[model samples]
Structure formats: structure tokens, C-alpha cells
Target: METDGGERSISGSSYKRQDEKFKSVRRVFRIMDLVSERGEDLTAKQLAREIGTNLSSCYYLLGLLVDEGYIERVSQGGGYRIGPALPSLHQGKPRSDFDARIEPAVKELAHRTQRHAYAAVLWDGEVVVTQVKSPPRSPPVGVVKGFHGASHALALGKVLLASQGAEFVDGYIDDYGLEAFTPRTIVRPAELHAQLNKVRMVGVGADFEEFARNLCCVAAPIYSASGKVEGAIGLSTTTRRIRDEGQRMTSTVQRAAAEASTLLSDEPDIKDGKNRKSG
Candidate 1:
């Protein structure tokens, strides 16, 4: 009734069941990998290409995933990003792995520079603070919340503007009307453009009390794996400390900023608040 290998016994009805389960698991992993790779959004057709499968097969797999809540169908933001089931992707893994990586790098910068280390990602034209870690003994200046910035003047803001391109920034300034938070803020459109040019070349930017007098900040842009400037990260310190400690941070911040780019590359699709929605 069975072959000499004994597989004939298990490979019959039992082996059929085992093989089906194995295939199912392999497919699930394939889907997860694809979603992680393309963070913005994906059509079934797009997913098919990435998975190197037929469109119909991709659709069926995606449907099963969507039904299982492994990925949510976002109605807004972008489309089809990693879903709420992401926590379970690794069997309820700790939430701090990515944050853990950014923390030490930032804390080191903050410790060395004596400033508040912060990270910002541009979302829908507004910058959102994804990470913020303060150094010991550093005084606060109330600059944490999202859009707690002026695109024209803040170092991070200018870094973003410069990365977006001149005309795009110019148009934004003309429309929004620079708030001119302090005497140091640059209100002139041409001047801001010129400053952006320098920011582009220098690969760093300084706030110089533009947002708040006696509060100065310096920042560098963070890029994603695709070389897109996904966000900006830097430090903010008081004028006194900046004069003394800020200069020391310039190189550290620059290196950290560059590393931030690589960090993002390693983590392509799962940044906080950078989700896409599916209809």
C-alpha cells in the first residue's frame, strides 16, 4: 500500500495537507515583503510585477491579506500601505526596534551638542515630527508638534524647501505669506531662494532665531533609499549654547543626517505617519 520511503503513506492525504499549508505560508511571506518594499501604494498590477506573478494571482493573494487585516485598505493618504496587522507581522514583536535605532543616534547627537535632537518628515506639504529626543539639562523652546515650523525660515524648513526645488518653494512662500516670526526671519522671496541655494550646496541649514529669538536651530536633510529627501533631522539649542556647543554639532549632525538617509533606506515602507490608504 505504501512505497519503501514511507513518504507514500504521509504524502497521500496527509502530505497534500502539509504541502498546501507550506505553500500558503510561502505566499504570505511574499506578500509581506512586497508591501514593505513599496511603501507608497500599489495596485494589484503593480504588486504582480513586484512579486513576479500573474495579475490574477496577485489579486487573490492581496484579497486574502486584506481580508485577514494584514494590510488595511486606506481610503486616503496614498494607498495600500502596510496595514495595522504589521505588529503581528513578526508575531507581535516589540514596537521599539526602529525607534530604538533612531534613539541612540539622536541621543548621541543631543548629548554631544547640548541641544534638542529632532526628526521631521514632510507629509502632504507639512512637516511632521516623527522623532524627538532631548539632551540632559537642555532648556525647552516648545517646538515639537507637527508643522511647528515656517517653511521659509527654519533650518529644517529651508532644507525641505531647497530639496523640493526653487519654483515650488517660491510659489509656496508667495501663497502662504511668510509669518516673519522674528526679526531674523527671511521674508523676502528672492532672499529665501538664495538661502535655499546655499542650503542645497552646503548640505546643512541654520535657523538663526528665525522662528524664535534667542533660539537657534541647525538641521540636515534625511534621504530615503530612493534618494528622495524624505525628511530632515537636526538639533535646536539656545543662542548662548549654540555659540559655544553648536559648532561642534555641525559635523556630527551632518554625519548623523547622512546616516539617517541610510537608516530610512533600510526601512523603506514603515515609517510613522507615512502610511498609505486603500479604497
Candidate 2:
């Protein structure tokens, strides 16, 4: 009887963990919908008060949503709002048009940097590659269009993740415990925080053979006209290539990203491939 009771207790603990995860996800979605309906910024305390939950719990949920790009800090309003991941111009026809508009720019970036260039966005707590431009002979390793994975492990992912802020990053780490893809992968919370801080200061994110054994990458953020982080653009190459010319490659990608962002703001109507304007 004692053995059976012990086994049941362990099973119950496993079930409780699964239940908590489910509840957390459900709460996050509820908060997202509430933010969308409000269509404005709401402080964590305000949200918590409205939802009848404690402030700490609200912060945890908001942090997770923000990290996943479902919510974003309001620049001028001083609170949280539904992020770009929610329904927006980018969620509809604009995305296809956006991709077409940025395709050539990415190709040019790849050509200039002599690497594989890519553009990615945060989607449902993961990084999704939306565009890619490979060098003539193809760079050694790179993410392709529609590729999705843990955002903490990729250059493109780290850039987007860094834009969300440290509190959100903490929530992300808590929700999706870092999985070491390679020996170099950053698995420690404090180390990843420091790395993200550097990215925040420099406007660049780097993965030095962290995701894969011999692949390296650098990335920069693409900003919306409102100064919000829209997504990221990256270049992937051999670790040796990055080591030999990482500084040059970083400068090239940053310039290209700036140009692309300018075009995104200056050309809102040039959607289809036919109306695409040069950046």
C-alpha cells in the first residue's frame, strides 16, 4: 500500500506540472485578447487589478507574452500593448508584400557580406525565418524561409529576443528552459542576460558556433517607423569566415538593415513585386 501511494504521489506531481503549464498558456492568451480589445497600454498592476490576480503573477504572464512578441512595451504610453505578433498591417497582405519588398535587399546584403542573409520575426514564442538570400555557391549553414525554432539559440532569435527587454527574457527562459544545441550554446541565465545586454547596447546580436558546431551568425534589428523592433535581419557563414571578417560583416549587415528599414517606412504602398522600389 505504501509503494502504491508513493507512485500515485509522483504521478500527481507530474500531472500538476502539466496542469500549471496549460493554465499559464491559457492565461497568456486571455491577457493578449484583453490588451487587443483595450487597444492601448496597460500597466502590469492595472492588468492584475482588472483580472483579479496578484501583481507578481501578472508580471510573469505579461513577461512571457512580451518575450514571445505577443505584447510589447508602449514607447510613449508607458505601459504594455499588444505587440506586432497580434493583428496588424504586417499580419495580413502586408506580410507577403513586405517579404517581396525586402527580398532584393536581403540578396544584396548577402552579396555584399559574402554570406547567407535572412530576415525573421517572432511568432508564437519562436523565431520564424520569413526570407533568405544565399550566396552564389550557398553559405555553409543558414536558416531557410519558414524555419522555426527556439529563439534563444539563433542569431536572428537573439536579436528579436533582446528587443523585448530583460524581464521578458527572464520569463522566456523560465517558460522554455534553454536547450544546449552545441557545447557553445548559452545555457546559463546570467550569461544570456549579459549577452543580450551587449546586443541591446550595440544593436547587433551574434552566435559564434553556438547553435551549430561550425556555423556562426550576426544579426541586426529592423525597426518600425514608431521605433519599435519589427523583426531582425541576419547573415550566416562559416565560423572561420566570421572570425576572419566579423567586423566587416557586422558593418555591412547593419548598413543593409538600416537601408531596408528606411525603405519599409518610405515605401508603404509599393507592395507587389512589380512596384518594388530600390533601397
Candidate 3:
């Protein structure tokens, strides 16, 4: 029923709810600004202390940032630090273009989630960060692209391997022999086999201080048009932040990655071609 006075009135609860969202968004932006200025990876504790806030609060904010890509987490000093995004600084054109067809979705994920989102393709046994988005930090850091590394010691590797089917993973384990990077690195073929199985079942894989000392990464595979393993997308963050958010973030990444694969399958061959041009 309209008010007899015909005047506009809003409920207190509605205004408060909107205000809460605004403040929360504002806080998250503030946290990103702090990390951008430091220009180095930061542990959750260190970040909180610098911002004169409690560790728990900082960690919570960091989780939001990671979920949104406002800041990236890396392994550092037995904790997490800042890392680059695929779109940051425009380092890699592939990351920005992401095989052209996938670019729109890739950028959308980065913008919608606000995480240092990117896509990767397995090239010659290496995981290539084909596209990335650093997100809009209070102070942004451009884009991070073309970040590639060994397939054995990173989440990107595990995701791609799992995507390749069990046979490829078995062969890779036999060839690489599960060399340990840190004490945490898996050094046995049998163990890796079991983990790859889990990755296959879950459609995602995780690195917990295995490759790098403190970096914890989560990844999921990208399938080719034929549903073959094409690549992966992941992020390296500190284990601390990962403890609570790993499963959630991995699920998000897995969904996005899987969608990317489905999207690839639906495209015309020339529109979303392979990461590389065949001669």
C-alpha cells in the first residue's frame, strides 16, 4: 500500500544492508592498496601488522582479495606473498589473448572474481600461463603472463597431467622420478600416482609447500575440443590463506577451467585455435 502522504521512505534494514556491502568492498580495496605499495610478497601476519589490524582480519581480507584477484598469494617465508596476474603489466600477449576465443571469459573471471586469474596450456611438459588478469588493486600491478614452469613441481603441472589421462601421468612420473624440490615435495612415483588419481576424481590438484617452500597452489585442467588435456589455470598463494580457502578457491578455479574447456569445444576451429600455430 502506498503511503497516504505519497512520500518516499526506505526501510532501515535495506539501507544498512547496502551500507555493509559498501564498507566491505571499501575495506577490501584498502587492503589491496597496502599490498600493491609494498611491492613484495607479504605474509598475512605482516600485512595485518602493517595495516594496524588483527591477523584474523587481515587473513579474512586476504581471502576476499584472493577470491576477487585484487591481490595474488605466493609462497614466502613459510607463508604467502604477492604474485603477478596474467593481465598485469601486459607481459604476455597470449595471456591477454588466451587463444582469442577464451579471452572474454578469462577476463570476465578475473573481473568478476577479482583474483589473479589466468589460463595455462601445457607446452612441451611445461605449464604456460597463457592469459592472466592482475585485477584492479587499489594500486594495480598490470598483468602477469607467460609464466611457465616445470609440470612436475607445480599445481599447474598436476592439473595438466591429470587432464592428460592416467597414462600420461604414469609416464611422466616414470620419466621425472618425482624429484623433490623442498622436503615437502613428493618424491615417490607411487605417491604421485595416488595424488593424480585424486586430482582426476576431483578434477583439480593442489600443491602444499611441495614445489616452493611456502607457496600453496591450486589448479584445474583445460580440455581440448576432443576433451583431451590442453592446459590448466591456477594460483600460488601462502599455505596460511590456503588452509581455509583452498577447497573453495580450487572449486572456483575448477569450474572456470572446466567451462573454458567446454567453451573451447563449442568454438569454430579457427576462432579458438590452439595455443600455438602449427607450421
Candidate 4:
């Protein structure tokens, strides 16, 4: 009887440890899922809150995941995103079919404008350039695929941020403070808010040497079928060129963005309060 009781106690203890180990594994995967879904937007504290764990435990898990290349820190921010290894775990192409379909429009824009054309999307809390098309022999405009940050100073980024409404913009400002890239950059939140209102009304956004001196850009929002802003398309060129042809450039960008929106009419609706009411 004594031997049987001892065996039962040992078995119960082992089972409890195994259950705890399974819970830990589950938490790790949950972290991965959140990082993948949010794209470089979740801080350690946010992840801890979402996963119902202590901050120390969350940091430990995040460290292990970073070491394993399942998630990585953002280049310019305090958040984590899905890492290279996560994609290699699956045997599928990295770029989506939608991205492939959108390239032709960007190419056409570049050809028409004879400048650098690009498309960007608001991936959770980051503005990521998804495609770039440049005219043959055109010089680099500093925008590239996977380019992100400095939304406060970029035309495409402005279009996306304006579409998300004032509340979302406030949260964005809170998360990533507006860093002035140039003298023309809108450093004041109130001023930026006013400019975004104009963007919402005019259906276009512009950067006049805000991101870089002697460079200018114009962009228009691309809407999904449900009327949510999903992305933006824009062109970048010298400031003098834009000054000489701002109206024409704006029109061309708006037309191309509208066409892309039609092509993406069936896209899934954005989640997490996209296009929430303005303040």
C-alpha cells in the first residue's frame, strides 16, 4: 500500500510538471502569433498583458524567441516583428499574390511620371514600403521595399496615417514620437493633425522637402471595398520638378491609386479599429 501511494504521488508530480511545460510552449506560440499579426507593433509590456504573464517571464520568452530567430527587434523602435526563421518554417513564397498584382500599377506610375514610384501600407503600427518602381536610368530616391519609419515626413506614409483617423494617429504619435527629419517636417502634433484633415478632404498627401531636402513626393490613398484605406501609391522626385508639376503629379497618383483600389476591392477588412472616428 505504501509503495502504491508513493508511485501515485510521483505520477501526480510528473503530470503537473508536464502540464506546466505544455502551458509554456503554448505561451511561446501565442507570442509568435501576436508578433506575426501585429508586425513590429507590440512591446514587451503589451505582449505580457496580452498573454497574461508577468513581465519578467515575458521578457525571458521574448529573449529565447529572439535568440531562435522567431522574432526580432525593430530597427528603429521598441517592438518585435516576425523574424526570417518564421517564414523559412513554411515552404511558401514570401511575397503575397496581391503584392505581385500591385507591381504593374506601380511600374506604370513610374513610367508615366518618369520618377520613382512606390506603394506603402500601414502594417499594424509601421508604414512599410511594399513595392518600388523606378524609371530606367532614374537615380535612387531613398525609398525601397521593406523601408519603414518616419511616417511624419513621407507622402505615402501621410496618406496612410490620415486614413486611420485622429485617434489612431494619436496612438501612433504616442508610440513613435514625431522626429523631425528636416526643417520642413511637421513636428507639431496639432499642425500634423490639421494637415491630415486636409488630406482626408482632398484625397491626396504631399511631402515638400519634409523627409529630405530637394526631394518631394505626392501620394493618394488606396481604399478597400469596404472603404477602408488599405495602402497608398506615390511618386518621388526633385523638389523643383514637383514644384513645376505638382498638379499633374497629384492627379496621376490619384488615378493610379484609384485603379489599384478597384483591383483590391475584395481584400479583407482591416481589423483593430482602422478608420476609427476622428477626435
Q: Which ten residues in a row have the lowest lDDT in candidate 3?
A: 270-279
Task: Report lDDT (Cα) of residue 272, candidate 3.
Answer: 27
Where does candidate 4 clash, by residue pair? Answer: none
Q: Candidate 3, TM-score vs. the true structure?
A: 0.55
| TM-score to true structure, per model | 0.58, 0.62, 0.55, 0.65
Q: What shift in Å separates residue 115 of candidate 4 from its native position after superposition?
A: 1.0
lDDT of 1 by residue, 73-168 (tens): 545444455553444243223223444446566777767665688876543343445466776765555365323336676777778778878766
Off by over 4 Å in 3: 1-98, 138-144, 174-177, 268-279
Report lDDT (Cα) of residue 150, candidate 2.
Answer: 62
Best by lDDT: 4
**Residue 108, candidate 4: C-alpha displacement in angstroms:** 0.9
Select the stronger candidate by TM-score from 1 and 2.
2
Question: What digit string (tens of lDDT, one per residue) describes model 3 on residues 44-163?
Answer: 777777666688877788886676544566533544323434233223443333357666656766676566666776654445566666567623322245444456677777877666
Cα lDDT of candidate 3 equals 0.64
- Once fitted onto the true fold, the runs of candidate 4 whose alpha carbons sit more than 4 angstroms away are 1-95, 266-279
Q: Model 2, range 77-130, lDDT digits (tens) per residue? A: 767655544432445667655666666778899888667889987654557677
Relative to the true structure, candidate 3 has a C-alpha RMSD (angstroms) of 16.6
